[model samples]
Target chain A: AQSVAQPEDQVNVAEGNPLTVKCTYSVSGNPYLFWYVQYPNRGLQFLLKYITGDNLVKGSYGFEAEFNKSQTSFHLKKPSALVSDSALYFCAVSVREGGGNKLTFGTGTQLKVEL
Target chain B: DAGVTQSPTHLIKTRGQQVTLRCSPKSGHDTVSWYQQALGQGPQFIFQYYEEEERQRGNFPDRFSGHQFPNYSSELNVNALLLGDSALYLCASSLAGVVLGEQYFGPGTRLTVT
Candidate 1:
């Protein structure tokens, strides 16, 4: 079984300050991790993914995440926060092989970037 | 390229009624997956279609079903819907056989079961 966990239900950060949203996972085999952001009444927008090789991965909207194998973590981070960035963020995972890439997602964390 | 597209932006149905949602995959993509997202929760996989076949499925019951056309478009059908069936139906498309490929999602169809 593959599962993802976002420990925080919400994260509040001031504009122009750095921010982080934590995520962890468990999978029977190698894991493919992803981050997605969603606005109200809209579908999720892909942020970034960690397939392999690099521990640090950059994604759209100046977002990035680091994959930590030892800690089984993939935490989304931004150097500077923007009020526009406030939204619901989700962490998902799939097994490297088999399962047809069926993703298991976390409950999600509401990101609140205030000015 | 046009991203994934789903029809019926919003729908309202009563309990025990049936519903069908449509989806068109991103151009050049061959796989379509359906997900149901309940209020305040993450999206849960319903099933996936490839080559006009049901390739993968989640924990959903038999009442939840889908079909894929030769054009790679797909439809999700639910029978005897329950009030709990209300949710945001998301359609995602990705290229098959590409390990690094990421799924692209549509704006989603909101289903309100009363």
Candidate 2:
């Protein structure tokens, strides 16, 4: 079974400061990881994904994630946070092969960027 | 591209009633998946439909069923609704066989059971 874990229930960061939302996963095979953000009353927006390439994957809205296979982690990062960036973050994992497009998602982490 | 769209932004139903949610896949997409998200929790997969057939299903009971039209639009029907069925139902669409393609989500239909 593929599973994702987001250890933090919420992350607080000041605007213009760097922000990091932690995520880890457990899968029997290679992992396909993704990060999505959802604002209140809106649908989830895709941030980025890590299939197999550079460890650091850049995504929409100036966000990026590092895929650390050894640590079984794919933590989302932003060089500078913005108050508008505050939203609920979700980490999802799927098997690299034969998983049939099904994704196992984390419980989600609320990120609050303050001015 | 019009993105994914769902109908009935909000709904209220009583126990033992039935409800149906609708979704239209994004333009140029052929696959649609349904998910149920409880308040403060991650979305749980209900099923996926492609080419007017159910390709895969989650651990949901028989009460949950779906249908896909030739145009790639879809509908999710829940029978004998329970109070636990109250949640935001999400619909996502993606290009089939894209290999882990990113799914575009709709705003979701908020269903409240009374």
How does each model score on lDDT?
0.93, 0.92
Candidate 2 chain B, run of 10 with poorest lDDT: B95-104
Pairs clashing within candidate 2: none
Residue-by-residue lDDT tens digits, candidate 2, B53-80: 8887888999999999999999999999
B10: Cα error in model 1, Å:
0.5
Model 2 segments more than 4 A misplaced:
A96-99
lDDT of 1 by residue, A9-55 (tens): 99999999999999999987788999999999998889999999899
**TM-score of each model, paired residue for residue:** 0.98, 0.97
Clashing pairs in 1: none
Residue A1 in candidate 2 has what lDDT?
73
Scored by DockQ, the top model is 1
- Stretches > 4 Å off in candidate 1: A97-99
Model 2: per-residue Cα lDDT at residue B68 = 99
